[model samples]
Target: MPNKKLTDVEKLAIVQEIEGGHIGINAAVRKFGFSKSTLMKWRNRYRLYGMEGLAIRTCNRSYSAELKLQAVMDYFRGELSQYQIIDKYKISSRTQLADWIKKYNGHSSLRAYNGGKTAMTKGRSTTWQERLDIVLHCLANGQDYSQAADQFKVSYQQVYGWVKKYEAGGPEALRDGRGRKKAPEELTEADQQKLAMRKLEYEVERLRAENVFLKKLQEFQRGRR
Candidate 1:
């Protein structure tokens, strides 16, 4: 929401060009280097509230739990799409609304917004088990990395890195590798069996998490269509 790149006048000019057919949306996106979604949001906001809507807020805005709940409920009523609900409630971005919907669906409590005060900006040391649990929580909650980071008191980068690493190389990849790796001959039969079982369990968990994310994405897309 804090877009220092474009001012209100500049935003209005671009929106007018797109609206007046002087430039197509795709061409505007290519020329202005803005995402299609961002451009479309500007156009919609301009239509709904004129130049006032396009003006960026100077300060951080906070929403109450009741307001968030109302907006989410309106969304579930199926009367308006995400953008419409966003425009109706003047929420900052679609991503924010999607996060709220994920929380609602996951049965997580929606507390009053405090302008992201609870988020950690710096990374912290974590063990392999803690990293794995954080990644699992993030994936299970539809990849809500911010929520996971806040809940675990770790930086967002750490949570994101762990999730990506796990997806690419499985659980063992999360290890810091500060210690020497055990040679194949150093492992006993029971040790090998335990390692294999843990790998299998992790794979199942990864697949289940992916399935949950895919289902949520599909549902959202279907609703939009």
Candidate 2:
């Protein structure tokens, strides 16, 4: 941590006030936030350097995000184990490595982002098929869009939108959606069962991937098998 800025003149005046014949240092601590040890340091510095006693200073700890991420990535690429990376990188915490690896893959190296200078990303909009699945689930249960949004933490507009899309197009509404017109729900109960099964089957794969990551210190294996 960096020291709070203080001027040489202010430090000298404080030193004089502490050393004044009529007052002791404890009274001064009450008037200012300085500790007794800080006052002592000021006194010693003043005696040695006269008016040049105050200057910016830092304590010993420095945490670097880039260095830690690089070490974590190296560990993931089979170059280092979790503990080995910690020792090699002089990382502040072992868990930090685990977290980065879990998030970014086996090689969770830090990548610099010229974030402010970067233009907005294009063509990566949310999938409407994904939207329709959740909306149908809500509608089949007779739940309102607001209630679903609250449960899922999406904006109200989004929740109602899926509801509107599903209402207009039936099952096909939940898709890489087309124009605002309804699509025919020509499928029978057997077909609807197959569609529902597709969603459930995909869900199983997602959970399995999550389980792999949460189980231990291992490389992430995402996607459905």
Candidate 3:
């Protein structure tokens, strides 16, 4: 059975039961069908703030930008791990810490990652222009998707997906609403030919660069003789 969301009252009662030694935490979790982590979270909250800490939050709490940056800096500075940050900040999960780090590192955005109404959106949305800009920047800088994501305020997955689409369909492929089952509008014959030509041009350019590198390597080898 799926784990049910426990109310604050229910959580407090369970914690109290365990604290009273009526049942061990492990046994209570087995009997109640709750995970050990869940019980541990409840116990921790209870210990820190009593019943008030277990209160069910109706809305997601928003952290200030400064707080988010501070947490990320702390992690980056090796001052603490995600778990330690959670305890220090009274945060509910390590995932929140990670999201803060991603946003601070320019791999995500405050608007996208903030625990707002639309926070549940799977990934950040990007326009075709932004996609093209990211792709071009990555190519120009010789950056992989991860590096591009960190430099461009986008997810690595997004960068990778956009590059694949651009390769398969050229600039036109970077348009929105990809991966959906609905067929996109038909491209003109000229547009189809243009995409093919663009792809070929990119491949030729890559090959030329590789050829130059190989020639340089051969010269160095010959000079070592």
Candidate 4:
């Protein structure tokens, strides 16, 4: 696993501090903000392999798509927590594993996740239907604007704006406004009622789908057990 490049003298000092019995390992970790496992790994390497093992190596390493998928599957199978998987696989960062899991669950392509290549980032305009779908999906998943932005590969401001517009005007609010004079922001009482009705319909549909998915997931878990 790649670590921040520390000088040889700094590495030896840290190892000495831990070994000198002047401070507990937990105190050293709290003071340095280093992971316990990381500190232990460094200490062991310094002891067994001398100063060379503690030396910073090249940071560039690549994991194949299949390997990433397998790691995610092992995580979901309840075999180990993310930190444990990191230690087991000698992964550099837990966030890398998390990104893999997110892509797998979202059914997004590896290239899209790694390259941040998405329709929203490719200069393709979104239709009202697409906007509505994104908004509803975010709401259904109980995602805040930031999480929605990451999951949907849109800007945080875009998700925030869409949600505000959706709450005020429902589906009609998402319609393209290009080359058209802006309408008044105020909605009539009847329009407000229609918006509320449409929002309720969206909520009901999302709940129904969630229920079915949960049932199927439970059945699958039972079969696995």
lDDT of 4 by residue, 111-215 (tens): 432444332211136776667777876786674554566566665446767878878866667888766433535656786675577568778977997899999
lDDT of 3 by residue, 1-225 (tens): 245777888888889999999999889878888888778778876776678779987766666443554465567658787767777777666667777766556544444236432111123778776787777656644546556666666655567668777777767678866574323347677866755665566567667877888999999999999
Write the residue-wise lDDT of candidate 2 on 160-210 in tens digits: 556776676666666664566343566677867877886676567556756
The residue-by-residue lDDT of candidate 1 on 1-225, one tens digit each, is: 334589989999999999999999999988888889999888977876788878887764577655676677678768999988988888877887898778777756666767434334457899877887787667766787777877898765578778988887666667897775455556688856866666567568778877888999999999999
TM-score of candidate 1 to 2 decimals: 0.43
What local lDDT does model 3 show for residue 116?
35
Please provide TM-scores, in order, for all candidate models, with all chains considered together: 0.43, 0.26, 0.42, 0.38
Question: Which candidate number would show the highest TM-score if scored against the true structure?
Answer: 1
lDDT for 107 in candidate 4 is 63
Q: What lDDT, from 0 to 1, does candidate 3 have?
A: 0.67
Write down the lDDT of every candidate, Cα atoms only.
0.76, 0.56, 0.67, 0.67
Model 4 CA deviation exceeding 4 Å by range? 1-55, 60-137, 144-153, 160-186
Query: Best candidate, lDDT-wise?
Result: 1
**What is the TM-score of candidate 2?**
0.26
Measured by C-alpha RMSD in angstroms, how accurate is candidate 4? 11.3
Error of 4 at 152 (Å): 7.1
* Winner of 2 and 4 under TM-score: 4
